[model samples]
Target: MRPTSLEGLPPTDNTEALEPQRTAPARSVVRGFMYAALGLGMMILFAGLAWSIRGGMEPPSTELETAPQTNVVSAPDPQIVSFKKGRLAYQVHCTRCHGPEGRGDGPDAMALRPPPRDFATRPWSHGETPEAIRAVIRQGIPGTAMTGWSELLSPQELDAVVDYVGTLGPLPSQNTEASDARKALLRRAGFEPVEPTIAASPLTFEGLDGRKQTLDQEQGKAILLIFWGTTCAPCMDELPSLDQVAKEFADAPLAVLPICVDEPDDELVREVARTRTKHLPLFVDRTGLARIQYDVQTLPCAVLIDPEGRQVGRLQGGKDWSSETVQTLLRTITSQATDLK
Candidate 1:
């Protein structure tokens, strides 16, 4: 006889024991729904964040400009003195002007007057000997853009860089009498010595005097043919200094001719040339071919020519012609021209 009333049955404990089983599935279902809601909230939050970040941003570009990559020389034999450290230092300090391959074709090469040395080919201005190179590394070229690295680099690094520069050039030979004579004309700057000095190209240009002439017309006098552009800041800075030089040497044997590489009709160039370089003869390379003929790849570059119309050497960069060294050099050139007569 089972009792029917609630809490009356002794066997009710058996049903109570099975109650958890009955509720377990429902708790699992509730948990699944809660997990789905949490996942959906996370997805919505991430999508909104992405949208905000992408707004007002530039479209990704496929035609981006690529910069030069560091091309460190390969590993060398351990027996030899390692230039690895020097190369690393060069990349840090010198590559802006000296270039990755030490070719002097660095990105800043064109902008710098006395453009960086073309270690791969051309002669150096100051000196190219290891001792000389080392000294320059330590002391720097005075009044020029080259600065000393003694403070920034250690002696070991200096020595290593010198060695590295040593490997870059077969500096113009200084052995023969002809070589010596050729170098003599370069007394003004690191004018590249021409072994068999070449004839000056008959560059035809328009002058401020409204006369059209060829470079050969100035053949009888020693020449300072300067190539400049209106855009180069250094060229503008060099104008007054060059003007003073031209006036000071007016009666001298040298004929200072500043030639503009800009278009003949460029009004800005014309105005600047007339006012800034008043003392010098004005000429504009109208054909746009003079630079190719002169091999002038940089601005404020000049070619020193003998009265015979032969190119002695070229000077690259703006300069203070009034400086003692430059004046001395100019005087020497004048004296030599007088002797040539």
Candidate 2:
């Protein structure tokens, strides 16, 4: 018999007595459910707080416009070099009129009605592209004192200087910053930006060898027009590579015209002549009109024009002309006719 808590209750089995005591587990279960609900509510509150904080945070800023890719020589870590070049080029060719650092305070600045460009402060007067800068160097601003320096500087030097000048004003798309820096280096070196004007439109040139070559007459052949000058160092570096390219495409319709833009300095010209360059046509721009026609501002600027006169590819400065990719591109371009025809 089991002992009973109630006095009148009959004695029961020990197991039956223990059954009432087991109700504690049910109470525990209820308590656990209540605690679980409280934890879930707190968790939801914390999650809402986190979301609010995230919503209050500012979004990231957008990026600026990027500059287009250019067909110009690129140097690594070109900024410092560009700055030095810009400063130097300005002092040499531009200091007389444009003043130091393009502030327009040069000795000759006092004579001009509209003072020379104060490059340090003003926005670019021209469009902000390599081609745009090239255009200004090739064609002078109509009413301004900015005269075209087509003959004054080599094409590579001119591009370098113009690239430098572009950096003075408001920054163009950052992609061009490298090019601008290279230009600065050129500027500091006392160089001017110039464009090559090739008269290849009608292609009439009385070469140094006295052979008359006309652009119109070379209709059936693909023309690899190379504009170069004697003073250009980059052009010198590119000659051997150009020789290789000429040799590789000898049997093809491709024709290499290496035209010298410098004045007839017989001794200097002879020393730098392409004598060993097989199958390359060496020509000279007697009147310097070629620079104007082709808008060639720099030396070692090469363009591959198709049979119909559409430009296929352009290589600026020194390049590995015999590289498989470049050679393949040449082979492909020469094989096809231009859409311009």
Highest-scoring model, TM-score: 1
lDDT of 2 by residue, 1-341 (tens): 87566777855788877877898898999999999999999999999999889867955434422544222222322433443554566567777987654567889888887778776543567765778877887777888788887787777567667766654444322245643653343333222221111112434454555555766666767887888888888877777888888887778777888888774443456567646455566776655556655667767787666564444345567666776656665665566544324
Number of the top lDDT candidate: 1
Scored against the true structure, residue 270 in model 2 reaches a CA lDDT of 53
Instruction: For model 2, state the Cα shift of residue 218 in Å.
Output: 1.4
* TM-score, per-candidate, Cα-based: 0.46, 0.40
Off by over 4 Å in 2: 1-200, 265-267, 274-276, 337-341
lDDT of 2: 0.63
| Residue 48 miss distance in model 1 (angstroms) | 44
TM-score of 1: 0.46
Residue 339 in candidate 1, Cα distance off native in Å: 2.3
Candidate 1 deviates by what RMSD? 19.0
The window of 10 residues in a row where model 1 has the poorest summed lDDT is 70-79
Expressed as tens digits, the lDDT of each residue in 35-119 for candidate 1 is 9999999999999988878864856544543544332222323213335566667888888998886777888888998777767
**Per-residue lDDT of 111 in model 1:** 90
